[model samples]
Target chain A: MSLSVKHLLGIKELNLQDIEQIFQTADNFKKVLQRPIKKVPTLRDTTVANIFFENSTRTRLSFELAEKRLGADVVNFAASNSSVSKGETLIDTVNNILAMKVDMVVMRHSASGAPWFLAQHIDASIINAGDGINEHPTQALLDAFSMRERIGELKGKRITIIGDIMHSRVALSNIYCLAKLGAEVTVSGPPTLIPKHIASLGVKVEYNVKKALEWCDVANVLRIQLERQHKPLFSTLREYALYYGVNKSMLDSIKKKIVIMHPGPINRGVEINSDVADSKQSIILDQVENGVAIRMAVIYLLSGKREME
Target chain B: MKTLLNSGQLNITLQRLSHQLVENHLTFNDTVIIGIQPRGILLSDRIVKMVKKISGNQQLEYGKLDITFYRDDVASRDIQVPNDTNIPFSIEGKNVVLIDDVLHTGRTIRAAMDALLDFGRPKKVELLVLVDRRFSRELPVQPDYSGHTVDTILTQKVVVFWNEKDGKDEVILIDKL
Candidate 1:
């Protein structure tokens, strides 16, 4: 018998088959989008609480949209506006929500592995939207789904993830997902941010952007280390852009079929050139659209309502 | 009713249905086939192999769907069993054929259709089933292709077993205890 995962706390909990299931469900869900009324009654009366400890617009909104589209009742819990500021612990807040009989919890916290911690304690199905720089499984799933849609297959494809590898959860999640889907993943950035031990996860590390670009089928340029700039991680943004930014010339040297991708709120002139961001090969928007479908698939599968259709 | 269509006869029907699926040209240009969970998924795999053999192409993608959440019976069932709905490939803009083992009251197909829409829009969707047990369907649903149609009493249970579930492929009609 195959093990069924109730909570999507981390990608580590999912094997190749589990990931494939979600992707397949997402494929079917995508068909509903073409209908006049896109909403489905699959999750009716199921209450989903979005507990975001960190401030976010895209991830939170996408989850909400997914929940709503699946006919679930959604309750948003913004940490800043909640009782957390009143000296309440994360566990206490979650326990209070659980007491209300919420069916599932989609949480985002600045603390790493917060979702995993909650999963150990809560009966409610847990979906980690983002937990610090630890992991973002859904983001990685959507990225993979988008890539599969565009590139046909992930097998033997070379994917170069450039930028702040150390702090970007997108990079971490993508590394796991890309490797699982049989893509040859490479991470490129300054030596400080690109850890040497990352290759343990079946990813090759490259410090030279040009070298990585030449060897890649897809270049996923990450945001510059602006949040960590004061730590003296890099000399300056200008130097980082010149050394690592996916500029027009850098794109020109690669295969014409090479597609560029980014997890949004892009620092246009920083990590990627403006012209390249707007280029034909860029699938940043496709990622956003795929995000909704992927999130919907996640919520539906985890709901655990198994009656014969 | 129990002896009318035995286990061995069911396997023969599925084998014949597999041939019909190939003959009907029921697949897509960029074919991505999915099976509704339990029996449907097993039948789908068998059909996938047969389809691949007929087309002489090994590139066809197959997936499984567990339409538990989408079922109309959710309100009535007190106990639920969660199964792995595994579809590893993307169905977007591809021709998707939803396969099932039996087509009964049409509720399962309705639920499966609802669940499929959540993934992504396919270019087209076609339904294929191993058995179309003629019963009063509550919904206006019909299979594009069927392997066998049996007229049976509503209380007669249709049980389909594949090599993955049981040791062999067969269909049995069980009288309710």
Candidate 2:
């Protein structure tokens, strides 16, 4: 069966089966990665354009690698290098690229709903890498994948998302994903960093970091988007670290060991201590590895939709 | 519909195929048996079990390979779900026997070969199948060890059912309605 929706705009748009299908497909892709020659010829006939309006290191490279591994021809368009700098509209730049016969578009933009906006104007399948603080679907998928790999099934599992919930696309996407998978979710951080309406999403909010850590099977720590913050939300980074930072001593205090996760560019010793980030319980690198597989699964499934004649 | 091979005949044919494999690759010293995923694994699993029972070599290297990622019609046709590909050991420089349930257009075999090569270069490669639709090959592929050969029209289909999976051991040919 195919995905009900052509574009993966957010986890909020995916049903449990869509998420499960992606995970199942990613399982095979993960196996493919373990082979001596990891590349496949599945998407040899397809061409994908990565159009990023925002800066990215891991996500962009992961998508490019996943596309290449599937044998898809990839063209990268960074806004800094492109005519998006010279007063070109997003539509104009994308339309010109679409004219070159791109079969799919994977994009990251600072503006929320940018990918959704592009999806309306283009026929090619659109995959949102990250659209502002709205969602980062692939990162969430990989995080869940990594979590499922470490722990068993996600259903009935307690997952606490710690750190900057208000400004994190990863946090928003993960909450939706985990909830759909029947996992109990909690968002924890300073009250200023956590969104006011977060509890409306059916997740518990914990101001005490240690209590959140004690209540969950997994702790997904999100980096504070310093650039996204317009004013001082917290008194100081040190105070935030002191109160909410996940450190070794805090983890040791928890009765049961909780799996630590971060959607990287980590503010080391801030949201998560380096000691904790490098700890054995952290499946950080596994998430990075699974990111390629998850992106491959997304692109492959999306590319399977027959091109319009 | 016509029965190609009944349960009794299917059983004997499998025994003969297993013995033939053992005769060619004695002791399986440097030879590996790989089953094409989904359907092929059923035949391969039985054959490997029988081969071990007869040769008394329990350590024979056998693997399951999925060729979904190597298909030529990936974008042009309906999407096929991928199965688990478990090749625990390397196939490099080994005499490889690729097993499948049916050899029809030979496209699956072609894709399997492409998938197989990605593991490493094999010393040699051979094809084995339970049923061979002799005249319908779209590519230049033939089975070295085939249980039964049948001639059929393009629209016809050959189906093999294993007792372990389908609750029966038989082969049937279905013509276009």
Candidate 3:
């Protein structure tokens, strides 16, 4: 199925069929990645802009690589280094960039709905790389792609996301993605970190990480948002580790080997143990690897034909 | 509207092509058969088996290539799912035989040529197509080995159905609806 939407604002805006089509296209692109010549000329004539309003390493690199591999001309704009630091409005900044014939914009901002707001004013397609605690659509797609690769169909699969659900864009996107794809999703962490009325999204709530791990096929753990939290000391790193940390011991307790996933910049012992993250059960790298292909699928679908330019 | 080759005729054409390949490169030493992916894969697989049988060469290297990304119309049409490119060994100095089911626009062949160049330079390259549609050329590409020549317009599509996977072997002209 062809993607009808011009901008991939968020997973909340997408249905199950749209996500599956992205996965289906991603499946083919993954094979292309395994070839001797990894690059494809599909997006040869298109151009992409990666506008990051926040600091990032994985998402930026993953998107840049995906765009480059698809043969699109890419330009990166960091808010910290760009005119956004000089008090330039996002509309003026993006419109100035689009004035130079930029075809698409993949932006990651600290403010919630930054991408949504940008999409309203831009003529070019806007892909929400990450927008505050709102959504990271590509991450959700890649996470679901990796899970679907390992465990056949995502329908009825048990997955529990552990860490700061309230602050994580990954958690919000994953919950919507997993739920829409027919997974039994559960959010587990300190009660304070869990989003309000999250249970209303139809996900089971679990406070204990051990209980969450015991009852799931995949543990999609997120890093604790320490830098974002300061005013209210909900839980210390030492205190969070005792309850939510996914270590080798906790993994051993579960008879069935569950897949471990973390959307990078891991807080190691705080969110999940290094051993568990590096273990055979860990598909963290696979998630990282799939990130590029998923991004390519998203970019290509959204960019449309080069002649349309 | 017209049938080019029936099941029996297709088998005969493939056997003849296999004989021609063996005659050119005896015993298949320093030769690799690479098929343009998605469709040409089956044709190459069939030809490789027949060539192995005819030449008594069991160690013939065969691979599949996808040229979706190398197309000229990438800017014109919606890019669909790409196929797998599997070439395990190096093609440094080997004589490569590029195989595909049909030669229509010749753009597929051109893209395949570009895709193949990413792999190490082959000593020589030969093109083989099952059905060569005459007079509708977008690129200046001609097949070195061809099964049958058919005249068609821009509106018609030449479809080659294999016996093993497609349940019956036949070539039919499908006009645009």
Candidate 4:
């Protein structure tokens, strides 16, 4: 078998075998983490470009760390600091970067499918870090990996993704990966925010938080859309939190050994209660640690020398 | 006639197998061996042990995976304990060899691959089984490395027991009467 993956654009593009290959590769890199020297010369000659069109600290840092750990020369590009502010088109900017002969581009863009577009146009391998409200495949993969580490298996597990489902790329990606792994996933938010057609993708849509929480083994609390407040998406933050936030009282209602997860830049005291955010059940930190390993796995699997046998 | 492999034969086979694995340059710069539970994992442990004794690299990471949840038969019958699928190491950018005790219908390896993805990605994945019984395969799959290949009928069963289970390591050919 020959292993080759040039680009990691989305979760939907991966088959079961491709996903396993990434996981297995990531498993090998775990050794470098334990050693006193946590750097490898595997990708010593490769250059990785981190192009973030949106504001992100955690994701950007993790990608940077992963690239550096794997011995790839990393170049960070932020919209505010780059030529984009000078009215350069994305294609022009990408072309300018491509002229430098970078090996791979990890992009976080505000427009949905921007990475997909770049993947089609560019010669370099593209990895979608986050793309608008469409998908954050790597985050979803790390979350799946984290959950698998804790729960052992994904089949038949009830996973409740609670909060602003409509504007969440995390929710979309998680739903896709979880469903693919045989999990029974539920997406719950205010009726206005939960897309009606989302159920077609093998996910249950819930308007009531309590009902969804009652049956979940994993409660993935998503950050509410503070930016959507004045757009008539919902009435008020206080009301939404009162109805949907995973507070201590709501957390007490579930008897299963539940794990709490949040993709960070968390709006503490809002989407998740303060206590629960710091509780023993919280794997938010684990999600961050796993993010590096997951991205490392993705990069290594896609860029490593393929074995044809 | 009953075909049997004693404990000593099994050990010798394993040493030869490990030597062959090294000779093929299968131990790439970044590679991981993941054992399919429960017997496959034990086999992986022994392979890792032998690899360490030969090279002393200490970089070889091993993982144990339970493919029950990912099995196609899960929907058909009741499942017992879905044991821990632990790969404390990451698989990204590494060559992966999935170790197993015996290769039969290939369905188990297929299921193991499905279960393996929940962890992370690997550069490549190769199947390594102790015994490759050349029976009718339900799936288009074969082991990359095998201790031995035995041609068997559909009615025959290949049983491999370790000392941990049966006080010795041996292979048994049993007819389903």
Report the candidate with higher TM-score, 2 versus 3: 2
Comparing 2 with 3 on DockQ, the higher-scoring candidate is 2
Cα misplacement distance, residue A274 of candidate 4 (Å): 1.0
Candidate 1 per-residue lDDT over residues A229-276, each given as its tens digit: 458888888888888888887778766568889987799888998999
Q: Per-residue lDDT for B76-153 in model 1, tens only?
A: 454243456666767788778899987889999988887787777888889998778876577899988887777867
**Which lDDT tens digits does candidate 4 get at residues B77-166?**
432233456778778777888999989999889878766665667778888888897766889898889987888888988888777767
For each candidate, what TM-score against the reference? 0.73, 0.97, 0.92, 0.66
Weakest 10 consecutive residues of candidate 3 chain A by summed lDDT: A300-309
Residue B164 lDDT in candidate 3: 76
Q: List, for all models, the DockQ compared with the true complex.
A: 0.11, 0.65, 0.43, 0.03
lDDT of each: 0.81, 0.93, 0.88, 0.80
1 against 2, candidate with superior TM-score: 2
- Report the Cα lDDT for residue B7, model 3: 86
For lDDT, candidate 2 versus 4, the one ahead is 2
Ten-residue region with minimum lDDT total, candidate 4 chain A = A300-309
Off by over 4 Å in 2: none
Candidate 3: residue pairs that collide:
none
Clashes of 3: 0
Window of ten residues with lowest summed lDDT in model 2 chain A: A300-309
Query: lDDT by residue for model 3 over A1-309, one digit each (tens)?
Result: 357677898999888778877887787678768766788777787889999988999999999999998889999998887878789998999999999998888999889999878877877889999888889999999999999889889899999999999889999999999989999999999888997799899999999888999999998999877667766746468888887788999899889999999999898888888899899999999999999999988887776633454
